[model samples]
Target chain A: MFNFEITALGNMFFGLTVLVFVSLFFVPNKHRSVTLYSLLFASLACIFYASDLITLFIGWEIMGWSSYFLIAKTADKQTLQKYIVFNIGGAFTLLGAIILIYGACGSFVYSELDFSAVPSGQVTAITILLLLTLFVKSGIMPFHYWVVDSYSQSNDLFSAVLSAIISKTGVFAFILIFFQIITVQYLQTPILEVVAWLGVLTSIIATFKAINEDEAKRLLAYSSIAQVGYIVTILSIMGSLSLEAALYHTVIHTFVKLLLFINVAAIIYVSKQHRFSTLGGLLYKYPLNFILLVVGIISLAGMPPLGGFSSKFLIYTALLEEHKGLLLAAVLFSSASAFLYCYKLVYGIYLGQPTNPKTEAYPRIPLRFYVPQILGAVILITLGTIPGVIVPMFNGILGSVGFEPVLYRGVFVLGSDFASFNGGVVIGAFGLIFVLILLFFVRLKNRSVKPKDRLDISYCGEVPRADVNLHYGYGMGRELSRIGLIKMILSRSSHALWQRVSTLFGDLSGITQKLYTLSAQNMGLVIFAFFTILLYMGVK
Target chain B: MQKGFVAYNNEQKSLEAETEGIKNSQTLIQKAMNWFSARSMFVVAYGTGCGAIEMPPVFTSRYDIERLGVVGVATPRQADIMIVSGYCSLKTLRRVIRTYEQMSEPKYVIALGSCTINGGMYWDSYNTIKKLEEYIGVDMYVAGCMPRPEALIEGFVKLQESIRNNTIQPGYVKYREDYAYYQANQEKLLGKETQPVYEEDYAGMNLS
Candidate 1:
C-alpha cells in the first residue's frame, strides 16, 4: 500500500521545483526524453510525499535507474560506469539503513520509529549509513568523483535540472531524516561538525577546479558542486536560523543555476563551441542573453541587489551567531575566490576579441532557449528585490519540521535576532546609483567610435597575423595552478583512492574464483566436510 | 632668389587663408570638445618595431607621461590616440589597419621614427612600406632613426595643440570621408583577403 504525507517542507521544495521539470517540455532535446523526464518527475513526487521508509526507498530506486538510463543515452562508457557504480553503491547503503531501522522499530512508518528505545550503537550505525547515502547523492567531497562527469556529459538542459532540482533532494532528505526523525538530541557525536568542515573543504577545492576548467560546461559543473557545498555546510549547523538559511539558499541556488545553465546552453547552441578559446565577443550579437548572464553571475557571486546576496548574508550571520569563526572564514575565502571563475564565464563567451572567424557568422539562438532563461531571471530579480517574500513560506516549512519560527519585522526586511536589513532599500539604492551613472554616460560629449573590424585591436604598431589568438579567456586562471596549495590540490585526484579500492576488490574476487576452478565433485566434498563439522559443533 | 621668395610667399598666403576659413567656421561646442579631447588623451601604444623599446621609458618613471593626462589603455575601444612606433612591415600593417579602424571617433595617429615616415633603414626592402599614411592616416611624425622619449613627448604636445585650436582635421575624419582610397591602397599591398568586410557603411562601400 502507498503511504503519503502532506507536509509544508515537501510542499515548499516541490512547489518551486516542479516548474523546472515542466521547463524540459519547452526545450528542444533530440533524444527520446519525455519518458525519462516523466519517470523522474513521478519518482520525485513519490519521494517527496512518502510517509514511510519503504515508499521512499522505492522512489529512490526509480529515480536512480531512470536518471541513469537518461544519462546513458548520450554519455560515454566511462562516464556511464561511474554514474551507475556510485549511484548503485549509494542505493545499497540506503537499503542497509532502512533495514536496520525496520529491525529496530518493527515498523516502516515515520510515526512509529522510536530512536530512544533503540540501542545507541544501532542509532549511530543507521545515522552513518543514511549520511553516506545523502553525501553520495549530494556529491560531497571525497565522494564527488562521479559528479563532474555525470553533470558535464548529460544533455545540456537536463544538466541544469540535475544541478538545480535533483541535487536539493539530498538536502531535503537530510532535513527529513536527521531533523524530524532522529532529532539533534540523539546525535550524541560531533559527526555534523566533521560534515561542516568537509563541506567547506569541498567548496574550496571545487572552486579552484572550476577556475582551472577549460570546457564551459565542466566549469559550470564544478561551480554547481561548490554551491551545493555551502548548502550542506549551513545545514550542518543544526540551528533554527541555520536551517532557515539553508532553505533560503537552496531556493536561490536553484533559480541561479537554472538561469546560468540555460544561458550557456543558448551560447553553445548558437556558436556550436564549448571551449572558451573558441568563443568571444558575443555580447553585441546577443545583448539580451549577455545581460541575463550578468544578472546570473552577479547573484551567484553574492553581490548586492540580488537574491544571492540576501541568502549569503543570512548564511554568514547564521555562522556568526553560532560563534563559528574559523568555519566562517573558510566560507568567506571560497566566496571571494568564486569571483574569478564568474568573470571567466562572462569574459570567455561575451567579451574580448573573437577567436574564431566563424563566430560572427553563427546563426541566432532559437526563441525557445530564452523562455526558461527569462523565467528564471524574472524569479531571481523578484527574490533579490524582495527576499522577505519567501521568509513566511520558509517559516511555515520550519514549523512543520519542528523548528522555532524566525523573526520577521516587515515584508521587505529579513534578519535573525543578530542582524537585519531591508531588501527594498538595497535594491533602491543600487538602482538610483545605476541610473545616475547611465545618465552621466549618456550626457558625455565624447562619442564612442565603432571598430571597423574584429581585427582592429591595439597591438602596438605591429599588425597581428590573422591566425593569432587574441582571446585570453583560457589563460586567465592558468596561473592559479602555480600557487602552493592550489598546486597540491590540482595535482591530486580523489579518483585514485576509488581506483585502489576497486583493484583490491578485484584481487579478492580473483582468489575466490580459484575455488570454483576445482572439479564439481571436489567442491561437493569440501561442502560436505564443512557441514559435518558445523553439525558436530551444534550437537556438542 | 626673387622668383623662389615670391612662390614661398604665395604658399604662406594660401595657408593663412585656409586657417582663417577654419577659424571662422569653428563652433563653441567644437571648441569645447577640442579642449577636452586635448586634455585627456588615452594612448593605445601599438609597438610595430624596434622603436617600441623607447616607449617604456616615456610611459614609466623616466618620462612620466601620465602627468600630462595621457594614459595607456589595453584595448582600441577606449583609445583616443594611437602611437605607431617604428617601422611597420607588410605583416604588421594588417593588424595596424585593424587597430586603427577599431579606435573610437576623433582618434589621432602619432607615427614615430624615420621608418614610419619613410621606412628608415628598411627603405627599399621588399616587405616594409615606405609611407605609412597610404595605408592609414598619419597626423604627426617624429623623424628619427628611433625617436627619443623627449621627442615623442614633443610630438604629443604638437598634436594636442592642433586638436585644441581646430587648426588641423584629424586623420580618422579623412579615413571616414575617403575610405575607398585607403582601402584600395591597402588591398593593393595586403591582398584582398587580408580584411573581412565589416557589417557597416564606410564612406561609399556598403560592406553589409
Candidate 2:
C-alpha cells in the first residue's frame, strides 16, 4: 500500500482544478466523456496527494502520458512531438532529483528527507535539478519554447485545463519540495535571487510577445506564462506574505484563464475563426459571452473591483515590504503593459466592426459554453467583493507549511501587517457609482437610433461599401512593435536558441551513428583501443 | 384644383403656427435639459474628406476643444453628435447614413466644408453625392473648401445655441418622421440589399 498524505496547499489546488475539470462537463467536447481525460485528472490528484517521492513520480508520469494522448487527439504530429519532448524532459529532470534524494536520504518518503544533514554541494545539485523541472513545466523564458505551440494546438477546452490547472502542478511541486521538504532557509540565496530575476524577465518578454501575437489562443498562452511568472517571482521571495500572495495569485490566475479561454473557445465555436483579424463585432450577437469575457479581462488586467486586483495588491505589497525596489519596478512595468493585451483580447473579438461579412450569419453560441464562464465570473466577483473569505483558507495552508498566517480578519476585509483594504467597500463604492451613472443615462430623454445597416459607419460623407475592411482588430496592437524596448524584444526569437541546440544534438547523433555503423572488426579494434588506453591510465 | 391648393397651404400655415406656439411655451426644466445636452456634446469624429485634416489640430494642444466639454467618442452608441467633415461620395454616404442612424436620440450632425453642402470641386464627379441632406438629416453646415478650426468651432457654438433655445427642429426628429423617404432614397442609390429591414417594424408583418 502507498502512503498518501493531504496538505492544505495540495488539497486546495486539487479541489479547484478538479472542480474546473468537472465544470467543463457541460462543454460538449468530442473527448469530454473520454477515460483518458479522467485518468489525467486522477493522476493529477495522485500527484497532489502523494506523500512519497516514488508515488509522486508515478503520478507525474501518468499525468504526462495521459495528457499527451489527450492532446494527440486533436493536435498535429509536430505539436505532439514538442509536447512530449518538453514534458518528458521535465519528467526526467524530476526523476533525477528524486533518485538523488533517495540515494542521499535512504528513504523515498518526503518527510524522511532532511537536506540539512546532506552535504551543501549535493543539496545545491538536487535543488537545481528540481528547479529545472519546475521551470520547464511553469514555462520560464528560454525554456518556454514549447508552451505557446502546445497551448495553441491543444483541444479548446483542454487548453483551458492545461493552462488553469496543469501548469500549477509545477507550483505545487515547488512548494512541496522547496518549502516543505528542503526548507527555503537551507537553499542558496544567490541561486534564488537569480530565479527571481528570471521570473520578472520572463514576464516582461512574454508580455511583448503576447501583444504581437495574432492568434487569440496563442496570445492567451503567452499571457498565461507572464501571469505564472509573477507567481514564480513572489514565491522566490520566501516570506510568509509572499507565500500568501503566491497562493492568492494562483487561485486568481486559474479562474481568470478558465473564464477567458472558455470565452474564446465559445467564440471560436460560433464563428469557426481563431485569428483576431477574422473575429470582430461579436458583442451584439453574443452579449452574455462578451460580458463574461470583459469580466475575465478586467480581472486579468488586475484592475480594482475584481479579484485580480486583490492578488496583485498583495504581490506588490510583498515586494514593497521586502524592499525589492528594482524587482517591484519591473513587475509594475509588466502589469501596466498587460492592459494593452487585455484590451486587444476584448476588442479583437467583440468591440470593433465586423470583419467577415458572414459573421452575422454565424450560429448562436450554445448555452453550454456559458456554464464555465459564468462559474468563473461569479467566483471572481465574489472573491473581489470579499477577498478576506479566502484569506483564512490561505492562512491554514500557510500554517501547515510552517509559514506565518496573514494578519487578516473579517469577511470582506483583507489586511497584512503593513497594509490592507476592505474589498466590500471597493465593490460597494463602484456599484453605487455605476448605478448612479446608469440611472442618469436612462433618465435622459434621448432615444436610441438604431442603424439600418452594419455599414452605416461615418466615413466622411462617403459610404463604406461592402468590400471595405472596417475591422480594427488586427491593426490595434501593430504599433506597439514600434516602441524601442518592445521592438528589440519582438525582434528576438527563442526558437533560434532551441534550433541550434537541436542541430548540435543532431550532429552528435550522426557522429555516434557513424561509429556504430563501422565494420565489426573496426568496431572491435576501437573498443580494444579504448580499453587499452583506459587500462594503461589505470596502471599509471 | 386652385381651391384645393389654397386649402392645403392654409392648413400648413396653421400647423406651423401651432408648432411655433408650443416651442415658445417650453418649461424651465426643458430649457435646463437642453442646456445640459448642449454643454456636454460627445462628438463621433467621422473624417470623410479634406476637412478632416483641420480637426486633429482643433482637438489637440493648439485649439483644445476639451475646454467646451466636447469629447470625441469611438462609437455612435455613446455619442451625441456626428461630425460629417467633408465630401459625401456614394460609398461614404452609405457609411454616414449608417453612423447617423446608430446615434441615440437628440443627436446632431455638423456637416463641414463646401463638399458636404454642394460636393465642392467633386460636384461633377460620378461617385460623390452633391447634396448631403437628401440622404440624411443635416443640423448645421460649416461652409468652406476646407473649414478652418476656428470656423468649425464657430459652427459648434451656433449649433449649441440652437439646441439650447429649441429654435429649430432637430435632424434626428425629422429622420424618425421621414424614415420611409430617406430609406427610399438610400435604396435607390445603394440598392435594396444595402440595409436590413427594421426588425421591430417587420415583426407584425407576415412577410414569409
TM-score of each: 0.86, 0.84
Local distance difference test values of all predictions, in order: 0.84, 0.85
How good is the docking of model 2, by CAPRI class? incorrect
* lDDT digits (tens) for residues A1-540 of candidate 2: 367898898899998877798789889686664789888888898899999998888888898888888888888887887788888999999999999998888889988888768988888899899988888889987778888888988889999998999889888888888889999878998888988999999998999899888899999999999999999999999889999999999999999999999999999888889998998898899999999999999999999889999999999999999999999999999999999999999999998888888987999899999888999999899888898678889999999999888758678887697899899999899899999999999997554446567766555434567778788878877897888888999999888887888899999999988877888899889999999999999999
TM-score of chain A of each: 0.95, 0.96
Steric clash count of candidate 1: 11
Which parts of model 1 are misplaced by more than 4 Å?
A33-36, A103-106, A117-119, A265-288, A349-366, A407-409, A461-476, A524-540, B1-16, B21-33, B40-102, B109-138, B141-159, B169-208
Residues B133-171, candidate 1: write the lDDT tens digits. 888878777777766788888878877877788666567
Model 1 CAPRI quality? acceptable
| Collision count for each candidate, in order | 11, 13
Error of 2 at B169 (Å): 5.1
Over 4 Å off, model 2: A520-540, B1-20, B32-208
